[model samples]
Target: MFVFWLVQLISKAIYLYTVLLVIYALLSWFPGGYQSSFGRFLAKICEPYLGLFDHLNLSFGPVNFNIAFAIIVLQLASQALVLILNRIAFMF
Candidate 1:
């Protein structure tokens, strides 16, 4: 039961993080968006994780494509974690 609750908490946290990522991506469309205090704070929390895919260089002619790739990766990871957590919860 405790493990189940822990899984639920972690899942909620991941969902919130995903939402933040979406907001961060949207904010990037505005001029000097990241220069704002709130934008910087979001970058501080999100950039490192998103940076992991930076080396992939998944971009087009002039566009940097990390945000979309990062979102997809994060969604896949969340689903995988939930599956593993559910399996563990079922065993006990």
Candidate 2:
């Protein structure tokens, strides 16, 4: 039961991260920039994770590479969620 709760918590965290990543990507499409209310909202949600790649000098030649990296990380999280569910099923 404790293991089940742990997996549930992890799944929620992963889902939140994935939602934030999607919001950030959508915000990137606006030409007005991240200063807008919606942009700021997304920035507030995404910055901590996105900031990690900011210092790396990573780029896709003017495109925001950070979003791509975040999506990849989220993808990994998704795979992890599937694996965890599979384990829980097997355990029962």
Candidate 3:
């Protein structure tokens, strides 16, 4: 039961991170948006994770799809974590 609770907690944390990423991306639209204090705070929180996909150049003309890969990776990681936790719980 504790493991299941942990699973849910971790899942929500991942989702919250994803939301933060989205917000950070949206903030990039305005001139000097990311330069604002709030945006900088978000950047500090989001950049480390997002930097993992920096090598990917998935640009379509004006739009950059780099963060999409980051989000997908996060989702995959969350699913994998849930599977692992369930397996561990089953061992008990």
Candidate 4:
């Protein structure tokens, strides 16, 4: 039961972070999006994670893939974690 709860919580967190990353990326579209308080708040949480993949030059011409890639990786990790947690839960 506890394991199920933990898995659900973690999965939600991962999904939320992915959404935040998308919002943060979209902020770049506005004239002063990143300069806003909300943008700053998002930067506090999203920048470091995005930084991990920044060097990959995920941009192609005008389209940037950094956020997309980060989200993909995060989702994959989340799925992997849930699988591991479910397996461990089954053992008990």
The top-ranked prediction according to lDDT is 4
lDDT of 4 by residue, 1-91 (tens): 9999999999999989988999999999999999999999999999999999999998899999988999999999999999999999999
Where does the lowest 10-residue lDDT sum fall in candidate 4?
A: 11-20
TM-score of 1: 0.90
What TM-score, to 2 decimals, does candidate 3 have? Answer: 0.92
List the pairs of residues colliding in candidate 3: none
lDDT tens per residue, model 3, 10-92: 99999999999899989978999998999999999999988888888888999998888888889998999999999999999
lDDT tens readout by residue for model 1, 1-92: 88788888988998899899889988979999999999999999999999899899988987888988898888898889889988988988
lDDT ranking of the models = 4, 3, 1, 2
In order, candidate lDDTs are 0.89, 0.76, 0.92, 0.94
Could you give candidate 2's per-residue lDDT for residues 13-42 as a string of tens digits?
Answer: 877878877877876677876779878887
Q: Candidate 4 regions off by >4 Å?
A: none
Clash number for each model: 0, 0, 0, 0
Count clashing pairs, candidate 2: 0
Error of 4 at 5 (Å): 0.3
